[model samples]
Structure formats: C-alpha cells, structure tokens
Target: MAADDHEFGGQHTDIKLEIVEKYLQRYSAALHTWCDAVWYIDAFAGTGSRTVRVKAKEGDLFEEPAPEYVEQRRGSAKIALDIDPPFDRLVFMDAKPKHIAALKALKASYPGRDIDVVRGDANDLIQKEIKWDGWKKTRAVMFLDPYGMEVEWDTLRLIADTKAIDVWYLFSLSGLYRQAARDMSKIDATKERALTRMLGTDAWKSELYSPIPPAIDLLGSLEREDVRQRAADVAGLERYVRDRLAQIFPKVLDPWPLPPKERPQRFSLFCAISNPSPKAIRLAEDFGRSIMRSR
Candidate 1:
C-alpha cells in the first residue's frame, strides 16, 4: 500500500513526527533508567520507512526516509519491532505472503541480529510468545497501529495483564466508528472485535443504533464545552481506560490522553500507557505535554 493511503502517513507532516518523537524519547529514556537492555515493538510495522518531507537547513525541503523515531540518535534505543525487516532485529510478521517476502529482503540487507520475520499473525505470536521470563527487568514498548481494527481486544488484554509491556496504541475512533455506523452489515468481524477490545466493553453497540451524530459532528461538539461537554466526556472515557489499566497494574501510571482535536492532522488520539511509577507517570505526562505544546 502507498504511504499516503495509510491513515498514519496520509497527511504526513512535522507534527506527526514530533508526537512520535516525544514518545520515543520518553520511552527510550525510561527504559535506559530501568534496565540495561530494552526492546521496541511495532506490531503494525509498515515498510520500515515512510516517504515524508522534513525541514532542512536549506530554504527548500525534500522527500526522504523516515522511521517512527527520526529525531533521536540511532542506537540510543534497542531493536525496532515491525512487520517489515528494515532492522536486523526486526520481527516481521503479517498475514500476507508478499509482506513477508518484502520483510525477508529487508532483513537480508541488515545482517547479524536476532530478526524473527515470521509470516503469521501478531495476536497469535503475542499469545504464544512475548513472555516476561528473560525480560523481567527489561522494558518493552509495543506499538499497535492496525490498518483498521483487526487487532483483538483479548490480545491487548493479555498484553496489558502481563504488566511487562507499555502500549502506544492508535485508537481510530473516527475511522472505526464511521465505518461501523454507516454499514452495520459491512463491518468486518475482526474490526468489531478489535473495537470491543479497545473500548473495554460492548457499550459501543449502543451507539450503533443511538441517534448519535456523525463522528465529525460529535468531535466538533466535543470541542465545545457549552454543548453537552462532549470533549470533557471523551476525556473522561480516556481517564476511565487509564484507571482500568491502573487497576490491572497498580504500578501503571495514569495514561496521558491526547484527543484528536489536538492533532487533527496526524491522529485522533495518542495515549501513553506505562507501569505505575512516579518516574513513568512523569515521563508519560511530559510526552503528552510536548505533543500538546507542539500544536
């Protein structure tokens, strides 16, 4: 698929880069403070690099290769997890054979690393593997960016229950809600399952039939405090998720929830979930604030 066709890079800009950079900085720094080794996992890893234009020293700009974290110095963090084998330690797993082949070629380019480019599903991989035995003291950040809603909630629940991994998930409220609301019959089963997992309940089913306006309208109203306080309510929902995570892992910190309006161009929501430690909370909050400030 083309970069522009993807929801993440469709409207690629510097702000998108900034939001990811902030999280990478905090995630990397936190791992460094906690353990001697850390692992970075991108469950929905794309073609390793995206075509984006960044500002240069000159007056003009040019399209170049950019990964999820471009600002940070290379080797500052450990392995990158992606379905594409751009890195040596890349764990490229996908349902498509072509994707696996692409990752294989990419992996061959980089030699001498623990790369596991399996042609399978990440949810199954996580269920069977991604343990906490050897990684007891080590920190791992899992980036879940599905194309639509193929990610299962049970998988996420299991991952969260482990308390050994922090998740940087892209919740496509607008995208998924829009599709499901428009055509209930057309909604993919995988997408529905993923939505259920992310919402932590079946409450969304009520919205399907409810006279709720379009997602754009709802988000617009949410932006205004006078009209039923939609934004506040959405923020509350995020808090609810954060609290639930805290209950599962008391050491897990309150998630720093960034609403879609904050970065309407790049994402609808950007939340950071980590273990409940003072340092972790601070780092998450700092990253969230940086995202808001960047806008």
Candidate 2:
C-alpha cells in the first residue's frame, strides 16, 4: 500500500518547508562528497501530517498542498537515509501518545524505509542509547519544536557539544516572555534555568534596565553578525535565542544572517547551526528569505 500523505497535521508550523529545503541545500553544498548518511530528527512530530494553502499568482484562489506532497519533494535528500536501511536514518520523537502512534502507523506503511518513531521526552531520550556512528564528522539536523518552554537546556548542551548535529530549534519567546516577565519569582525554576541556558547568561535581565528597544537591541550589538543577525534579524531574535546560541558556539560557522524583512513571522525567530560550516547559516538565510518572499 502507498504511504498516507496526510498523516501529520493539526500541529502548528514549527519551521516551514522553505527553511528545511535551504538546510538540505546547504548541507548538500558543504559536503565534499555525498554524505554517508544524514539524520532528520523531529522531536515533536505532530500527527505526522499537515495541510497548507498556497496562493495563486493570478487570482485570489489558494491551493492546498498535501502534507505528503511537501514531504516527498523536499525529502529527496533523505532518500539515502531511508533506502537500504542505510546507517543514516530519520527519527521522529514526540511526547504525545497519539502522535507517536500515528507516526508508527505511517512508518509501517512505508516498507524498507528506515524511519524510527519513539514515544518519550526528547530530553530524556537523548540520554538513552543513540547510534552516532554515522553522524560522526557528518551532518545531522535536529528539529526541536516543543509546545512551549519545556525543552531542557541539558539536552541542547549535549547536542551542541556533540559537534555532529546542527540544531533548528523553536523557542517561543512570546509565550514564555509574557508569562515570566509578569512575575519572575512565580515562574518555575526549571523554566528559568532553561531560559538562562538558552541565553547563555543572566544578562537578559538587563534588558529591563536599558532604554534600548527590547531584547533585539542588546543582541544586535554583539560582534558576531550571526549573533546580531539572529537577534535583530527579520523575525526578531527574542522569539528564539539564535544570537545566544551563536554566541555560546562562536567557534562554529557564522550564520548567514537574514534581514528582518525576510523572516516568516513578525514576532518569531528561526535560525540554523552547523559544525564549522557557513553552509548551514547561508541556507538558513536563504530559507528565511524564501519564507518572506512566499508571504
């Protein structure tokens, strides 16, 4: 039976297809040769399907693209990972039971494909046995999209230190900033710790003191354009800590840096990281620009 295309919907759009496409393009460009394997891990794999509308250039008409259509087209780069059970694999993890089950069912329908669906907390699961053999010195993209601020800092640190995986994470600053800024004392310690870790310092509190325009101003002053771009770049860095991550991992490749106008959301931020390769950053910028153009 052919695999179902509309299996993972009703979930919010974390990072859109354009961003993923650019990452794939950049990763492919940076590699000297075809990669031995590549892993695309989705930590919050919704129902495994989504429906999106594309506007027609001529008319007010909009066309809906099936989730499978988008996945299959952009997923070509993933063929090696799925074929022959290549050491490279695509892993989808989600805390939700229904989402996990749906992913498992979808995997079953696609025989000979090496897609692993696990039900568990991504933070805890990363600590478990994971085969990084194929990932060593190779590129892997991990999509970290949590519902809110629940993602653990430890997990991000572990992944960052691995030097193997380039992270594309979604940090919902609007949600957390609104909640935490109201009463710092009332916020959960874990959430506070996670925010601190994400920012790489307690200095974020200083934003309240400065007359500058919110968090974007502080982030933009950093020497690293990647850091500055991520913060003040099109989507607004405070929405996500692109600048902070770039600051913490300065040794890694600098980001391509998107202009504010190119980002998808006026209030959100999106960026990418790779091991000592500007390819990821460039791709991220291209993706960001594409998203803006699409709008």
Which model scores highest in lDDT?
2
lDDT of 2 by residue, 1-295 (tens): 1334433212234234445455545454444256766666777666555434433344335854434323322222233233332435678887878667767776776677678888888878985644466456566777675656666656766676666676766666555455444334445677666666655566654432223223335557644222111123223445235555665442333223322234343223345454545654555456556655654
Q: Assess each prediction's global lDDT (C-alpha) against the native.
A: 0.52, 0.53
User: Per-residue lDDT for 120-146 in model 1, tens only?
Assistant: 787888777865666556666667766
TM-score for model 1? 0.61
Off by over 4 Å in 2: 1-15, 25-32, 51-87, 127-134, 182-194, 197-203, 206-240, 250-267, 277-295
Task: Indicate the residue-level lDDT of 225 in model 1.
Answer: 30
Residue 39's lDDT in candidate 2: 65
